[model samples]
Target: MATTTERVKESLLGVEEDLNMSQPNRSSFMQHAIKDEQTGEEYLNEQGFINAIAPEGEDYHKIKRDQYSILFNVADRNHKGRVTLPDWSVFNNLLAKPDAEYEIAFRLFADPTTGQVDFNTFKEIYARNKTSDTIPFNWDSDWASLYLGGKKHRHSMTYPQFAQMLRGLQGERVRQAFLHFDRNGDGYIDPDDFQRIIQETASHKLSDHLLTNLPTLCNITPGSKISYANVRAFQNVIREMDLVEMILKNAINKSSDGKITRVDFLNEAARVTRFSLFTPMEADILFHFASLDQPSGRLGIADFARVLDASWHSTAGLVDQGVSGPSEKPVVSSKTFLHDILVSVHHFALGSIAGAFGAFMVYPIDLVKTRMQNQRSARVGQLLYKNSWDCATKVVRNEGVRGLYSGVLPQLVGVAPEKAIKLTVNDLVRGKFTDPKTGNIALSAELLAGGAAGGCQVVFTNPLEIVKIRLQVQGEALKAAAREGEQVTKRSALWIVRHLGLVGLYKGAS
Candidate 1:
C-alpha cells in the first residue's frame, strides 16, 4: 500500500483530471477544487520548509522553536503547511533590495526557472552551505566581480562571517589608536602622557563629572591599551568627541578669519556647563529665531532673557484669552469654576481612555512595521524573513498566533501618554475661546493648546520614545554595545536627562 501522503496526492490528481475533462471552464467547481488542493499543498510545503530548517533532535520543526516564534509565524503564509513559490517570490524580491535581510532564505531557495522553491531544494542549499568544512569550494571567495574589478571569488557570508569581519576591522583600528595614543613608548601609557594628551585635549574638557567617569568608560587597564574584543567600548567616547568638534567647528566658522578665539571658546564652555549637554547648531537656530535685532548675527544675555520672557508671557496670554472673552468669561464664580474644572477633568479622562483604546488597536501592526523597518539587506537562501505577510504568517506558525504582539506592551505604554496629553490639552485650549456673537469658540485655542501639549509631551515621552526607537531600530546589537561598555546604559528618560538634561530635550527651543 502507498503511504498516507501518496494517497492524498493520488486523490488530488484524480480531482484535477476530472475537472479538466468534464468542466474545463466550470467556474464554481474548479475554483473550489483548486482552492482546496492549493490549501493542502501549502500546508504540506510549509511543514516541509519548517522541518528543513528545524534543528536536530526536535520533534517539531525548528521554526517552531522558542527564539524563532516570531519569525516563523511571520513567514507562514496561506495558512497552508507550506509557503508557495509565489509567496516565497514576494519575500525574495523584497529581500534582494536594501534594508531587508530577514527574507534571505526565500532568495536563496527561490527557483529562478519555474519561480518556485521546493522543500528539498531549500534544505539542500541551506544544509549544504551550513556544513562548509566538508564542502569542496571556498565560501569566502569574492563574488562581486560583476560590479567591481572582475575579481571573482566565492563571496558569500553568513551573519557570523559578517560580524567577524567587523570585529576584525575594529580590532585592527583599536590597536592602531592605542599605539598612536601611547606616546612615551614605555610599553604602556604613562601618567604624564595621559594628562598631557588625553586630559588636556580640547575634547576631554567636559566637566569634572565626565572626567571622573572616564576611567569607568572603558575596560582597559590603567597602563595598557584596550584589546580587540573591547574596541566597541570606545564608541561613546568617539561619539562625544565628534559632537564637541562639531560645536567648535561652527564657532570657528562664524569668525571672519575662520578661527576660534578664547572668548568664543569660553562662551560655548559656559553654555555647555549650564546645560550639561549642547548641540551648538540647535542653539544657534534658537538664537536666530529669537533675535530682536534681526540682522545683528549676534545675541547678548538680554536677548536670551527677553526670548524666555516673551515665550512665558505669550503662553500665559493665550491661555487667558482662551478662558475669558467678550461672551461671558464662564462667570468665573467659585462654584462655576469648580463645575468647569470637573467638566474639564471628565473631558481629559475621556480623551485619555479613547487614546489608550486606539493605541492598543494598531500596536501589533506597528510591531510588524517596525520589524520590517529594522530589516537589513541580505542574500537569497540566507534571510530570516520574506515579506510582511510571510512575517505575520511565520509568527502565527511559530509563536502560537501571539508572536506578532511581542513588543506591543511597550509601544502602547509609550504612545498613550503622549496622545492623551495632546488631545486633552487641545480640547481644554479650544474650550477657552468663546464667540462673542454666537457663543462659539474658534479653533485658535486648539492650536495654542497643541503647542503647549506637544512641548510637555516631549519632556515626558521623549526618553521612552528614544529607547523604543533604539530598541526597534538596532535590535540586540545596541544592547550588546551597552554591555561592552561602549554605551552608557540607562533608562530612556533618565539617560536623556543625564546626557542631555532639560535643554537637551528642547535642543532647538527658542
Candidate 2:
C-alpha cells in the first residue's frame, strides 16, 4: 500500500495531467499553495492562483480558480483543511531540486511557531524569489526592512506593521506617479506642467477649476506653485483620480489607437464599470464630457483628463469659477440608464427581426430541401424529383404558387420566438458565467450558452419544422394516392397532432 505522502503526490500528479501543466509550471503552482488553518488542507486562493495558470480571454480567471482548487484538494493528504509539510515535501521533491535555494524558500514560507505554511506566506516568498535569483534572508536587507520591520524587530510582521507596509507601498507608487508628471527635473508642478502631463498620460483635459485650484487644493500657500510636499499630502486623492482615468483609457482604447471613438467609449465604459467602484451614471457622464466639443467623437488623452478632472471635482463639490460655479449642481442624466436597457434588448430584437425576415425570404427554398430529403425511393430513377429545381418547378406547376407557402404562416410565427429565445438565452447564460470580480465571461460559458439556447429554441421550433416538412411532402403523397385510385384524405397539422399525440410534433427532436 502507498504511504500518505505517496498518495498525495499521486493525486497532485493526476491534477497536473488534468491541467496539462508542465513540471516547471506545476512546481510553480505548488510553491504558491497554502494550507488552510482550520482544516490543514492545502489550497490556493483564486486571485494568486489565476495569475499562475490563467489562459487568455474573459473566462480565464474561472478556469484558473477551478484548476487551482483541484490541485489543492489533491495535495491535501489527510483530507484536512491544510496540507502539512510532509505532503508538500513529497510533491516538491518530485518536481523541484532539493537545493539550498529551495530550503531557504521553504523556511521563509513555513511558520516558525507552527512549522506550517499558508498561502500568504507562500505568496511573499514566491514574489521575492521571482524578483531576485537569491533569497534575501538577511534581516538587514532592504527587502526584509520593507516587509518585516517593526518597533521590536521581530522575525515576522505584526498586523500594524503589515498595514504600515501596505501604506508605504501605496506612497511609493504615488511618488513615482508624481515624478512622472514633474517634468524638467523640477521639484514643483505648475499649470503648464500639469497640462502637459495630463495630455501625455490621459485621454481628457484637466478642468479649468482643477487646474487653477491645484495649488490651493494641495495646501500650497502661493496658490500658483505645487511643491513635492504638497503632492505628498494629496497623493491619495491624486492616486484615486489617476486610477479612474487609467481604467477609462484602458477600457476605451481597445485597438490601442491612442484615441477613443464615442461608440467605443460607451461600450467599453459599460463593460469596465459594470462591477467597478464607479456607478453607471458617473461613467456615462464622463463619456459625455470626453466627447464634448469633438464633432468627430474621438477623444484623446487631453479629453480623458478633462473628464476625470470634472468628475473628481464634481464629487468633491468644488466650484470652478470659470466653469460650473459652486451654486450649480452636477447634472445626473437618465440617458445612460436608457442606453443600458437598449443595449440589453438590442440582440434579442435584432435576432427576432432577422429570423422573421430570413424565414419569409428563404422559406420556398426550405420547402424544396425538405421535400427532397423526405423522398425514400431506393432507386435513384424512382426518385420524386430529379433535382431541386425540378422539384420546385413541379410543385409550382402542379400545386400553384400558393402550395409552396402552405405552412409558411406557422413557420413565420415560430421563427421569431425561436430566434429570440436562442439569442436572449445565450446572452443570459453568458452573463451567468461572468466573473463577478472581473466581469469577464469564459469561452466555456459562451459555448454552453449557445448549446443551451439551441436546445431551448427546439421546444418552440420542433412543431413548426415538423408541420413544414409534412406539408412539403404532402404534394407527392397526394399524387401517389391519385395514381393508385385510392381515396385519400388531406392531413393538416392539427389532424396529425391529434392522431400521433404531441410527440409527433417533435418527430426529429433527437
Candidate 3:
C-alpha cells in the first residue's frame, strides 16, 4: 500500500502543489502599497517586500506576516513611519557605507576640493591594507579595466561612484553565474539549472528553505524558466539575509527556551526588527512551514533560520541552540585525532618552556635549602649557617657564586618534563570531554582532567627530584672542607643517574 506522502507526491504537480503549500491558518498574501501621509507617495511596506521575493504561490516558503499588527513597528525605522529605500541601502552597506568607513577612506585618498581620486590614489587605497608579499594591484589588469573604465589614468572616481563600483563587483559575479546557466543567451535560466548557480555561490550561507523555494518562484512558463531580472531581485534578497537574521535574533530573548510561538514571533519581531521585509501573515506562514524541531512549537532559530539566516545558527538550540542548556553539540569533535594531538603538543611545549624558566630563576634558593637541611653539626656554634640569607652569602663566598646553583640542571630538566606531561595529559583529556559545539567542559570533566595531569607529572618529576637532591648535597661549604685530606668527591647529573640505576632512582618516589 502506498503511503499518504507517496500518494500526495503522485497526485500533486507544479502549481497545484505550490498552491496547496500556502497556509490557510492566516490571511492570504495580499499586496497593499503603503502611502506615507506626509509625502502622499505609496511606498512598498513589509508586505510588498515579501511579495517581491516570494511571489504568489507557495507563500509559506516566504516570510510570515504580522497581519498589520506588526507593520507600524517594522516600517517605522526611517522616522517617516515607513521603511525608506535609504534605510534598506544602509543596512545592506549598499550605495553608501553606514559608518562612513569607505567614505572617510575615500576622503583621505581623494582631493578634498575636487572630491575625486585619480588612478594613483585609487591603487594606493587598494594597497593600504595589503602586505608586501601580496600581489600588487595593477591598473592594467582585466578586473581593473572592467571595474575602473579601462587602464586610462584620466578615469577619476568619487565616493558615490566608488561605492557603486565596490557593490557592482559582487553583482557582476552573480550575473556571470546566472549567465552560465543561460546557455542560449536568452536572458532566462531553467529553474533547475539556475538553482545550480545558487548552490555554487550561496549554499553554505543561505538557509535550506530559501534555496529550495526561491527557484520555484521563477517559473514564467514557455519553458518554465526564470528571467534574469527575477534572478537579480532574488540576489538582492540574498544580500539582505544578514540584516534580516540580525533583526530576527534581536526580537527574541536568548536566555529563554529560545522558542517563540507564531504570534509571539510576529509581535516580538515587530518590537525588535527594523525595516518592513516581512508581513505578519508572511512570518506566521514561515513559522508554520519553516521551523524544524519542536514539541513546544518547532520555531527555534534553526527553523526560523530556514526562513531567516545561515550565518550564526543561534545562541541556544531552540533560540539559537538549547532551552535550559547546551544541546546542539555533537558527541564527537570534527577535528582529526592528529590535529588534537598537535594542538595539545603546542600548548604543552609553551607550558614546558615557562615552567623551566620559572624553576631556573628560583633554583639557587632551592640549593641553599638543600645544603642547610643536609649539613651535620654536633654543636649549635659549629653550625655552617644560621639562616637562609647567611647560608646563601656563605655559599657564594666559598663556592665562587656557582655553589648557590649547584643542582639547577636537574631542577630545570625536571620542570620541563613535569609541565610537558601534565599539560599534554590535561589537554588531551579535556579535548575528549569538551562540548564540540561550545568548546566547554563539565565541572566533573574539568576535575578529572586536572587529576589526570597531576598523576602524569609524578612519572618524570620524581626521578628529576631524586637527581636534584643528589647534586645539591654533593657541594660542601668552605668550613666543612677545612678538614685536612678529607676529600668529598662531586658527582655530575649523568654520573648520579648512572649509579642510581633505573629502579634505584624511583626508590623513595612515594
Candidate 4:
C-alpha cells in the first residue's frame, strides 16, 4: 500500500539504523541502553530497531518488497503490471522491474514469469545493477589486479583464488574483466592494444641492470612495430632476465659483496626450475647431440635460439639478431641413440600387447570387415546383415562357429608387426623431422610422415587381409549349388589361389 519512493526512503532509513546498531559498542538512541531502576545496569532495548531492521534473514523479503512496489506503481514504464523488455533501458534497478534486466532479461522475456523473485533471486538483483551501468566491465583492473598486482597474487593465484573471486561477485567476472581491460575508454578491447598494454607493463618493471642491458639485448629493427609473437618472445626473455634480477635483489637485501656467479645461477636455476636436466629421452637426444664431431654437451639455449631465428627470417618475420650468428646442427649422440632404441623397444612391446588385447576384446570388428568385403556392394551387405550380432549369428547358422574367426590367423600374426612398426616409425619420424635444435617440427613433414605410415600399414597387411575376406564370404550357397543347381562353384582360399592366382585375392584393393 506504501508508495515506491516512500517505502524506499523508509527501508533505507531502517537499513542505516540497523548498520549503526550492529557496529561494535554502538547503538541508536531508541536502541540505547536502558537503566534497570534497581541495579543501574544499562541493558539494550528497542523493538523498532530490532524487529523493523532488515537482518540477513529479511534480505529476500526487503528485495521482494522493493519489486512489489515497482510492480504496483502506475509510474513504472513497463506495462502488464511488471517490468518488461523495453523498460530495462530506463529502469536503473532491474530487480525492481517485472522483466529481468541482466540474465533474467532473457528468461523474463522468454517465460514472462507467473512466479516471483526468491532467495536465488540474487542473480536477478545483480543483473539489474549490471545492465543499468552503461560502461563495459574490466577484469584485469578489478579482477586480475587483486591477485597479479600484489605479492600475494603476483607469483600465481591458484584455482581457489579463481573460485572465491567468482563466487564473491556471483557471475560478474566476465563483465568486470571486459570493463577493466577496456583501457581505451572504448567499450571493447581490441587485441592489438590489449597486447601492447601487457608488454608495456611487463617491460616497465624490468630491473635497472636489465634495463641498462636492453639496448644490447634488443634485436629490434628501427621503425617497426612488434608483432604479438615478438612481444611474447620479448616477454619470455624478460621473465628470464627478471629471475636473474631477483637474485640481485636478494643479494642487495642481504648486503653481500658477491654477485650471483655462474655457479650460483646454475644452482638457483636448477632449484627454481627444478630442471629435470635429463629426462631419459631428452638425455638420449642430448647424448646424440654431444656425439657429433662438434662435441657439445647438448643443444644449449643459444643453439636452440639460432634455429628459431633462422626459421623466423625464412618466414619473413621479425628476426632477432641475438639468435643469428653461428651454430652447429645437433646430431643424435650414441648414448641418445641407445636410449631411443631402448624406449622404442619398450613402447613396441607395450603397443603390441595392447593391440593383441584389443584384438581379442573387439574381434567383432574383423567379423564385420569380412562380411562387408564379401558382399557384392556395401549397401547390400549392410542392409542384409543388419546388426553385428545378427551377422555373427547368420554366419554360424549357415557355415559354423569357425566363421567368426575367418581372418583370425593372419590377424594374430599381423598385430605385433603392425603395432610395433607403426609406433616405432611414428616416434622416429616425429623426432627426425622435428628440428631438434629448434624444437619445431615442420608442419609439412608431420603430414607427409603420417600419410606415409598409413599407406604402408595397408600395403604390408593387404595379402593377409584378402585371405581373411575370402574366408568370411564362404557359405552353404556354393555347397548346395555344386550338388545340384551348379550356378557358381564355391571358392576356397586355395581354389581362388589356383584359379585367380595371387592378384585375384586382392579384389577389393582397386
Candidate 5:
C-alpha cells in the first residue's frame, strides 16, 4: 500500500541496496567541472574551485570569465569569498530532485537569513508539501533523520544523501519495469519476454548485438525464464555506460595509439564512477566481448564504441556552417547513366528476390490449383481428381512428393519479370498520380496504379502460366493413357517449349 515517494524515501533512509544513479548520469558540463576540480574529496576550496571552473588561454577573457563567475556566486550565498562543502553540496543538490520536488522544498524551507535546514525547517517543508498536489502521502521525517545522522552530523543534508534519494527513485523505476514484463503473474519472465524488457528499458546502455543477446546472459539455459536478479544486473550496465564512454574517450585521447588496455579501462572506470561499476569478472567479460583480432587483444575506441551506446550517435551530418551562402539551387537533372544503371539493377535484384522467395514457398499449392483447373472429362483417358487435397494425394502417389512442386522452374522464370515489371511500373504510375503536397494518391490513382501493374505483369506471367500448366498436368495425362491402353509418353519442359514455339505460348492471350 506504500506510494512511490514513501518507498524511495525509505530506501534512501534505510539500508536499502538498489538505488543507482551513477556519476555519468549527471549533465556533461557538471561532470566536466567536477572532473576539473581533481580534489580527492567531493568539494574544493574557493581558489581551487575558481581555478578549475575558469579557462586560462587566450579565450579566457570577459565573456568566459563572467559566465563562470555567475555559476560560482550561485553556490557562494551571502557573498562569502569562501565557499564550503555545504554551500556547494546544497547548490548542486538541486539536481537530486529527479522525481519529487526537494529543490522547491529546500528553497522554501531553508532558513532565509541563516540558510540552514534543521528538523524544524524539514517539518515546515513537509507541512507545505502535504497541502499541495505533489509528494504523495506517507513520505515523512524518517529519511531526514537517517541522512542527517552519521559523520554528516545531523545539521543539514549534503549532496551524497540527496543523490542517494535520487538513486532510490531510480530503483523503484527498475522494479516497475520488472513488473511490466512479468505479465503472466508468474515470479519470473520468459527469455523472449526479457528481451523486450531490456530493449524497452535499457537500450541506451548497450550495442545492438548486446541488446539482442542480453536475454542469453539473463537466462540460465537457452530459452529459459529470467529472474529479477538477472534483470537487475542487466539493467545495471546502462547506469555505467556514460561513465564508460567518457573514460574511454579520455584514455584514447591521452594515448598515442587509439587503443586502451583492459587494466587502464578498469582503473579509469573505478576512479571516475561512484558504484563498483565493473567487477573484475565483469571487466574480463567486457574485454572479452570487445577484444580485437590482434595478438595484443587490445581494444581501440572504435571497437569499444561499437559495443557501447550512450545514446550519443547522430546522423545529422555536420553542424550548419558559413550561413552567408546563396539560397537558390539549380533545377537541372543531375543523374548520369551509371546512376541510372545502378538504380535499375538495385530494383531488379529486389524484385527477383521477392518473386523467387514467394514462388519457392507456395509453388506446390499453385501446382495443385493448376492440375485441378486443367482436368478434363475423357471417356477413355480421364482421371477423377475431385478437390485440391485429393488431387495432391493422387499426384504424390503417381509421381512422388516432387509432383506437388511440378513446374516450379517455369513458374520462377515467369515470376522474376512479373514482379520486376509490376514493382517498377506501380511505383512510377503511383508517383506520377500522387499529390505533390501530401504525397498521397486518390482512390482513382490507386486503381490506375494497380491496373498498370497487373497489365505489365500479364505480359510476363501469361506465357509461363501456360508452360507451368502443361507440366503440372503431364503426369495425369501419362497415367490416364496407361489406363486407357494408349502410349504413355512423358513430356519434357524443352519438348513443351518446342511444341508451343514462341507464338503458340500466347495462344489464349488477351
Candidate 6:
C-alpha cells in the first residue's frame, strides 16, 4: 500500500540517521544497498546522488520542472511557451558572439510562423554552437561578400554586417532599430532621427545648441539626410562615450555598490586621468562641474550619464571644428610651433606683470619695516617710531604720504625681471636635471634648482632692496638731523649711485 517515494524515503531514513551519527561505514553500506539489481554496479556516484535529490520528503521531478519553467518564462517574455526572434535576440545579446554569427544561428533554427521557437530546439542549437570549434561558413571570403557586401556596392552595411560590426547586436534587432529611425525609408536618417536616437539612447534632452549643430556633427549639410557612413561615424562616437562612462563607473564603483561616494569619485577621477588627456586637477574640476546636482555625495547611473552626455557634446563640437577626427592625429606644423612660443611669452609677460603689481602694493609696508629695523635705539620706545604702523603713520604725516612710496618705481622695475629670471631659471634648471629615462626630477635636484634660481635672482634683486631701504630711511634721517639742529638734504637714487660709485650700488651684495 506504500507509495514508491514513501518506500524510498523509509529505506534512506537509516542511512540519513547514520550520516547524522558520523558513521565511518555509511558509504560502504550505501554502496551495497543502492546497487543496480541486474548489473550489481552502484546506481549513483557520491556527488551525483547528493545533488540529484533534495532532502528526504521533497519531489526531485517537481523541483526540476519548476526550474525549467522559470528559465522558459524568462526567455519567453510573454509566457507564450514558445520563444520568438525578439526573445532569442535578447538572450543571444547576453552571449559573447551576439553578432552576425548569432543571427545566422537564429535563422537556421527559427520557425517563420508567429516567430516562435521551441525552447528545447533553441537549447540544442545553443549547446552545439557553444561546443563547436569551427564555424560552417568561411569568414573572410564568400561570407563577407554575402553579409558585408563587395567593394563596388559597399555604401551601407547589411543587417548581418551591421550586427557583426557591433558587439552584442542581432540582425533582427538592428533591422527594427533602423526601420524605427529611417522614417521615409529613403535610405537616409535625418536630424529628427538623430534627436530620437539621442533621446532614446542617452535619455538626455538635446539642447538648442546641440540640435542646431547636429548636422555638422553627423557630417551632413543643413537639412540634408545622414548617410550610413555618417551613422557609422556617430556609432563610433557613441561607443567611445559609452566606454568612458563604463571606465568612470568601474573606477568609482570599486565596492560593486550601485552608488559612488564623492570622495571615491574624486580619487578615481584623479587616478584614471592622471597621465591621460586631462591632468588630475583638470579631471577633478570637470567632475565637480558635472556633478553639481549630486548633493547626497553619491553618484548613480543617471549622474554618470549626464556627465558622459556633456563630455560627448563637447567632443562632437571639437569634431565639427576639425580639432579632432576619427582615427587621425591632429597635424602639427610651424603654426603650432609659433602658437607654443606665443603662449610661453604670454605666460612670462603675465608673471612679470603680477610681480610688478605685487611689489607696488606692498612697497609702503616694506618702507615701514625697513625704517623701523634700520633704527639704532637700545630701547624700543626710544626708536624713531613705535612700530611698523607708527612708522608708516609718521612717514605719511611728515613726508606728505609720497615719502612711503619713495623707491617704489625702482623696486617695481627690478621686480619684473627678478621674478621672471627666478621662475625661468628654476624651470630651466629643473628641466636640465630631469632624468632622461624617467622624465622626473629628483627631490635633491629640485632643491638645488630652487637654490640656483635664488642665487641668480640675487644679482638683480639685491641692488633694488639696497635702494629701497636707503630711500625709506632717508626721511627719518632728515627728521633726526633737523631735530639735532643739523640740516640734511634729500638725495635721489641717481645722485646716490653717482656719489657712491658702482660698488655702492652693490653695497648689500654680501
Q: Give the C-alpha miss distance for residue 33 in model 5, angstroms.
A: 56
**What lDDT tens digits, residue by residue, belong to model 6 across residues 169-281?**
32223334555667688767766665555444433323233333454433323446766545454444344455456556776557476667545654664576644433333
lDDT agreement of model 4 with the native: 0.43
State the local distance difference test value for candidate 3.
Answer: 0.59
Q: How should the candidates be ordered by TM-score, best one leading?
A: 6, 2, 3, 5, 4, 1
Report, for all candidates in order, the number of backbone clashes: 40, 25, 24, 16, 1, 0
- The residue ranges of model 6 lying beyond 4 angstroms of the native Cα positions read 1-146, 149-344, 376-381, 432-439
What lDDT would each prediction earn against the true structure? Answer: 0.43, 0.56, 0.59, 0.43, 0.59, 0.52
lDDT of 2 by residue, 1-510 (tens): 977555433433322322333455456556667766787765555443444333224232112234344434434445554444454444334333323233323333444444434435745655653434322223344544557543356355433344445446545544555566566777877755444333333312345534443433323245676666654534333445665666666755565767775456446655765544544434443445444545455667665654355333332221111112121123333247677567658887888899999999998998888878886553556877889999889889988998777678778888987898898888778866875423457888888998999999998899878776776787778877787797889887777667767888887898
Which is superior by lDDT, 3 or 5?
5
Total backbone collisions, model 2? 25
Alpha carbon deviation, residue 339, candidate 6 (Å): 6.2
TM-score of 5: 0.35
- For candidate 4, what is the TM-score? 0.33
| CA error at residue 444 for candidate 6, angstroms | 3.7
Angstrom error of the Cα, residue 216, model 6: value is: 40
Q: Please identify which of the two predictions, 3 or 4, would achieve the higher lDDT against the true structure.
A: 3
lDDT of 4 at 209: 32
Which stretch of 10 consecutive residues in model 3 shows the poorest summed lDDT?
A: 319-328
Over 237-310, each residue of candidate 4 has an lDDT whose tens digit, in order, gives: 43344343444344334434433333333444455555533223222322232223334432333232331222
